[model samples]
Target: MAKIKVLILDNDTTSRDILNKSLEESKDIEVVGIAFNEKIALDKMRLLNPDAVIFGNNFNDLSASLFTKKLLEAYPGKGVIIITDSNSKNQASDTIEALGHGAFDVVLRPDPNISDIEKIKFIERNLSSKIRCFSIKKFSRMARLLTPIEETQPYNGNFKPSCVKKYENSKFEIVLIGVSTGGPEVLTNLIPEIPKNFPIPILIVMHMPKIFTKPMSDSINRVSKIKFKEAEDNEVLKTGTGYLAPGGIHLIIRRNLKGELYVLFEDTPPVNSCKPAVDVLFKSAVGIVREKAISVVLTGMGSDGTEGVRALKENNVPCIVQDKESSVVWGMPGSVAEAGLADEILPLNMIAKRLTDLVMK
Candidate 1:
């Protein structure tokens, strides 16, 4: 029942005042403080401990990444929402970069439309809706072509915990997946297979519009025994739970005050052509889990995961890609596979089976 306090961070005075007025007027959100630059932002952050910080990414000058990076080091708990007037392309690219720098969400603030639609209804629907109300849809779709990783391999993948040869180990602590187009269907199929008692946490970055992700996560939780929730800034990654990054925001992994890894959501623009991008999460896990990490890039429509997958591969972490046949759009996964970054390329149907096999081994 408590109001969520928000702090506004922007260099523009008019922008700050407008956001202050808008958030202060809302019953759900309380405007705590406003800052115009990094120095002022940090000062306000120390004194006000707001629940969320609304920062802007669009710049007539330099981007907001470095400032965000410094701000996080000092004030790590405030939920970060990065606002930008970027198109889908630049949004995705910057999203990847911000997550790597430890940002949480890449949010697209509405640009001045020559035509206003009464109010900012679109963003309100996407960013403000309750996500835990929907029914989870069953996994219905299948890929149209080849299936090798599913057929040829048992789940005991090339994973070793104490040694480099075992790229995947049985003692998996977390399941971090980066997905794009057609990801929901793939997840619906894959998540139900993760036992309710599964001992690791699962995190997904399914690139989508912010409005739909909450409902999508809510729907997913309905079918799976695992508790599912849309990620919040600094929320823990407990086992037997699944988290979906809110669309339009980038999700990153961070250690909490308890020293446990938790989620950080950002509202900055997209990185690598998409917010909730694979590149961001994959690259983060490289450091978080090192050899213990398992990065999977499923079907999507862009080359977003290519660089992130490469980072995982270089770290000797096992990187899996949903093969071309199983993917609705192959841009995301295909680039990783073509770059020789994937340790296993599996079909849609057997990805769960193989994962089970690997984790159980």
Candidate 2:
């Protein structure tokens, strides 16, 4: 794996130096450089090309937000963490704006007190535990709580119910979904309400850390009528069960001699800053199911699913994207919708019905 390169931008020489020193000792993170102000950060952004940035939210300007836009424009894939003291309201405003500009997440500056220092110590020492917990929580649920998609087709055999929207035969036999960032929330709303005996099975990819998927799967199963579980490698995608890609791995589908599709997960390096990258699964499924597949791109934080949607469209598979207002981050689904790659764009409230209707002939 390549190093997670990081750059720090803080006017406080003391704090900047301290953080630089701390992360320099990290095995997973590489401290590439540090800057005392926004201008220097921008200059080094192009020069250093770090994978992540830790910016101090204290800007010299009082009325205007800092270089959040410049940073986003310079490096679209770079992750960011804002460190701000509690003293400045502008700090929070800038942080939110930074997220709006495509920062990954935020963190608070730890107090200098011994207790807070001890907490940092605990976290630093338990880094493995934190990563593990997030991974396990990704797909632990077996049911979901949701409302039937309101504006689209219901699970019942309704509408034209044709693959081409004009035929009598239902064109969709497989439900393949791709998501990230806010995927857990999306699943909690859609999976539970899908009625049983719906015939088709669901295959999903939610970009997440390891140990987080199982808990999510368990939670979904308890609330929804259908069963949900993390996809076990080589497990068959069956009816009434929704398969989620395991965290820290790529979940793919392959066909046997009899044309049976089996779900599989592999521990490969992240394809797009995500282990369970939606693109990996979605692209694979397009070849496996072709015109019989119904692909849905849900709320997420990147363009990971966009290319996959393109692949689906090229192969005659019908794909949909979640509409903008319903998306939390709006990056993944938005790109596909904008590219005219998806056949339909609906809100979360209407997605299930649209999907179900596609499946009913």
Candidate 3:
């Protein structure tokens, strides 16, 4: 296996050294270059062509957002992770903004007051793991694109190409979506496209930290014509209102004695290494709605939704997967596509229209 070449960008000498030493400790990672400013970073990127770049908290002269955007524009396939202070007053907003600007991921730096040994351990464990994950995803994407279409099955045996014609008898009751990694940005683009009068409750399971999910919900809601907020335990599900699965807990659907559907937040242990996992939400939806459910798997980094999608398919529920061309990472949706489970595979822009057509028609 080839080592993941990395470039460290940080104006702070201590931070640069910490990231360099920690990342170098990994057997599969090699530090190719270091840059203390945007100009130097650009130069290093051209010269080294590293697999990933780690950006520290402070940029020498450029705004973090601008720098990130410019870097991504210049190096489209290269992975970028921004390190921020965990204790910062603006951590949530900053992290969200960075993600919106196209940074691959964000890592919170260890508390500055910690012992040097502990700080090194923290950097190694957190930063190195993120770098490896990013690099693996980068390589996986390249591999998928390079492989011939004939070698890869583009359409599944169970694939339903047109939901409008195929599910004439199916009454869509709910929209259940599963996303991760690049979810927020995709949601930002998708949620607003869903019109206010669209009549179906939408439940989303996005893998995010406890502090970040609420802000993400707020951010989406601000731009969307349809309202969205974090799911509250026992809240009755309603149409035209999207519910985001709260972080640190799984969001499932259940019925009260009156047979009315409501959101149930579970404290159950993480499934597929993700709390509020798509599987949990999709399974819950399947139990209640069965064939009436409309399951959509969006861009994400893992196969968290594959099993749940399988269960939905078993019940004759319609499933939609985001097309690979429009996905930031196709792992979740691709798994369903590979399993021959999706009813329709559409690009991101077409998904909202299809959802509305399926529910309203």
C-alpha lDDT score of every prediction, in listed order: 0.66, 0.67, 0.80
Q: Model 1 reaches what TM-score against the true structure?
A: 0.57
RMSD of each: 17.9, 13.6, 5.3
> What alpha-carbon RMSD in Å does predicted model 1 have with respect to the real structure?
17.9
Query: What tens-digit string does per-residue lDDT give for candidate 3 at 207-248?
Result: 887777887898889989998998898999888999898788
Of 1 and 2, which scores higher on TM-score?
A: 2
Write model 1 residue lDDT over 1-361, tens digit each, in one string: 7667677787776556555655544577777888776667778878888766677665545355666567666765445566666454454445444543444444556656623342244444433321100101111123232233445555454432234347434477677788865565567667776767776788888887765566567667887878988888878888778899887778888766676878887666778768877788877777777666677888766698788878876667777788776676677888887887777787766676666665666
Can you write out model 2's per-residue Cα lDDT over 1-361, one digit (the tens) per residue?
Answer: 5656678888878677666765655676777889887778878888998766777666675211346567666665455556665445556555545544444444456555646345445334433222222222221121121334454444343322244454225466678888875566677778876777677789888875444566557667777777788788888778778887776788888888877889877777888777888888888877778878888898776689888878877777777788766665668888887887766777676677666665763
**Shift of residue 231 alpha carbon in model 3, Å:** 2.1
Worst 10 residues of 3 by lDDT: 139-148
Model 1: lDDT of residue 174:
74
Name the weakest run of 10 consecutive residues (lDDT summed) in model 2.
Answer: 136-145
Instruction: Extract clashing residue pairs from model 3.
Output: none
